[model samples]
Target chain A: MTAVLCRHFGLHHMDIAEDIASDTFLKASEHWALNGVPDNPTAWLYTVARNKAKDYFKRTAIFETKVRNEIIPESIENEGEFDYNGRIIADSQLAMIFAVCNPANPSESQICLALQILCGFSVEEIADAFLTKIETIRKRLQRGRKNLRNNSFQITTLNETDIRSRLPIVLRTLYLLFNEGYFSKTSSKQVRIELCSEAMRLTLLLTENTLTNTPQVNALLALMCFQSSRLDARTDIRGEAILFDEQDKSRWDQSLIQRGNYYLVNATDRQEVSKYHLEAGIAYWHTAPADDSKWTHILQLYNQLIVVEYSPITALNRVFAFAKVHGKDKAIVEAEKLGLEQNSYYHALLGYLYAQTAAAKSIAHYEQAIQLTKSPTEKRTWQKEITLLRQDKR
Target chain B: MKEFALIFRLTDISDFQPSPEQMQERMNWLGSIAARNQLVDKGNTLLPVPGSAKTVKPDNVVTDGPYTEIKEFISGYIVIKAATIEEAVVIAKENPIFKIGGSIEVREVLKRD
Candidate 1:
């Protein structure tokens, strides 16, 4: 079913392909429920899909004015019924990925459309995944599709020459897919298994493709593998989020760590460093921790990241890394400038800084943090930090 | 590109004091979502009643009166990118305000140009 859909998508319009697929399923679903299961469900689905495709083209002759003449003859419609041996040149999913995430549209729209068309996510599901309104995701998807059509987007043929230029966007899309899987801001549940698996599948595909087998691609795959290995440990048995320091190291997959190390070496082969390279370095540091003192190198990487990204969020992250290297004083000095004191993490960081200094102002920061944070897990963590600070002073 | 104004009105503020942790959680949820989606060009949450001055004209005389209505106050809004009214409606359905109690009025934002 997947292969047939891919083939049809490449030869015909994707909108037509999608509509045909949807009609086929609607018929199959209704038919199967009444007539019991068919002997060959895949074949049945193909016949339906092909017939729907023909009907769609016939019906939409007005809007399909651009390529009205390109439709295959009625006799050829049955030819795609069972061409299992025929060459499947380009992957439809690949075309869809490039078409949706085309650089012509905004980044958010790219991600939203990719999630919807490629991953088959509903607007509500995507909204939950990114912790945004359903309207935002819907608009992004709609706009992205319109833009792609208007721009006459040409999907980058995943060949050796164009791979280097387009690889970064693909990798970023994969990263977003994985992050949505690993830590969904909207789902009350812990993780999105489907999204995670889809991301992993795409990454594996990228690694397998001769054109996309770059050191950075390998590094991204490795990072995903290593990070995913600990997904089981990220949430407690109660299904609440577990802080990184509290996670059971024994639960971390050794094989994935080894794979991560392999990619880390590959990523460093190029003298130029990207954010993924720094991220992989951080992941590696976490993997092989003799003590918390070894985090200085990781801090240096975050410093480099801030210079490149110049995000207040990145700067906030670097402050914690600084605490691991220097004392709380240096870290607090950095954190103070981030203006995150109005947020929850700021209070948690403040509480820790106060614990180190036993200063009266530290309590105020902790209180502010407690006031700002929303999650129960985060609140508890900050509360614990505040309690410890008070205990030390007493 | 078409324009749409998402008029988000905060409804039913329960006698709830969101602890700092809750505030952080909300901020993280909102900030990350906004960053990922880029839904708004710029937005600011209005204070409950940021000292308002109202002039009441009664019998050809002007008088100062605090004019407030619970149902029709504009809390906040975001101007967004949309192609059509249906698209705007689809986007509005996903708003946090529209979940259980609150509502968002999605209208085409008029362009000056």
Candidate 2:
């Protein structure tokens, strides 16, 4: 809806487009309750929205007579525009994705805007995804919109010259968006799936576009698909976090794995490899049965990923992969040097490594992990492990 | 086989905004039942998005509000063919709605031959 309205209201009126879309939904809810949903709901929504836009333009003093005549539709009925215009809407939405991921704004705000405007995510969802407060998300979004409005930002959707250059920021925003949804501890499984799906949808959009169909986009899509296939198995029936080893392999979505393979194959169309490509490679290896070969492949990918973008978490994960590739003792040496005492996962990994060697050290590490962990679900799982580990203390 | 109506009731859906994935999950749940040849009738849902629950009585009397006063509203229903109410309940137990605080009442449907 924002995309469709962007076409009529122009790029500067993106917020106005959003308001009109919301108003259209409000009108639908009220009228549909009184008169029942129409035979073709999307068609009905399109017609009503177009009519509302026409009325809005007629009443607003934003434009001169000449501009109003040019911008506003003649009549909602005369155009026979009852159905959804998918092609144009996709193009408009692709433009919005690029526009919303403005490099001028803080990366976090860009993601907040993408979630709120592009994905129809409520502030609460965004907050839950980021483990932040609702007020903080609202303020961040307000700040982003303020920057756009105060600057009279012109997105210039047609400019293909810099589209290739601007792809990184957009991809980064999408990667962050996907990670928040896929890896969030507090959000329900449904929210996780929704946000991950939204990120994948946008990435797929870029892949389908003639100009933006880069290998990087395909790699990102592949990574999302691979991760999404394991989403259901990531949590147990009680909603407790399940580590990858404990997850029921049968529960994984096979079709999605196949789809990920297809996209990964497509990503190999070019020579340049990205962080997404390496991540996707690791994720693909995870979908297969756990073996020495699988661990070796995953370790290699992690090594590449760390080199491409070195973060503390990446280093920690690479160590885990190293444990799988080499041995636990060597991996423990590498992990101890990282100095990630604040990270719960880091502690948990340390506990796992020390379990077979020094039982007391393992128990101590697990206890520390239980202390540092914020999620009650994770705390419960680790506490149970500590109880079992204590039995073998002697 | 006997028929049963599995009425889906949701608790306080005022803020429920069904995402693309949630909608697809709902469809998959229904599809699973249909695949098992248990689906008798796929009923319409009073979705929170298009929420409209009206009560009509005799003599042109009607009320335009959903049953939010009771803190629960009939979101949807589906007819399923099962040998017993217990069997019908097994099918109802599979609904994704329960993940989000919804209930399914599996009542045997009366049939006149």
| Candidate 2 per-residue C-alpha lDDT over A67-145 given as tens digits, one digit per residue, 9 for 90 to 100 | 5555444432333443357776887788888878877799999999999888998889889888889999999998898
The alpha-carbon deviation from the true structure for residue A257 of candidate 2, after best TM-score superposition, in angstroms, is: 0.3
Least accurate stretch of 10 residues (summed lDDT) in model 2 chain B? B28-37
Best candidate, lDDT = 2
Q: Which segments of model 1 are wrong by more than 4 Å?
A: A1-13, A30-44, A58-90, A154-156, A159-162, A265-268, A337-344, A370-377, A387-394, B1-113
Please, what is the whole-model Cα lDDT of each candidate in the order they appear?
Answer: 0.64, 0.79
The list of candidate 2 runs beyond 4 A from truth reads A62-84, B1-113
Q: What is the lDDT of residue A66 in candidate 2?
A: 66
Which candidate comes out best when scored by TM-score?
2
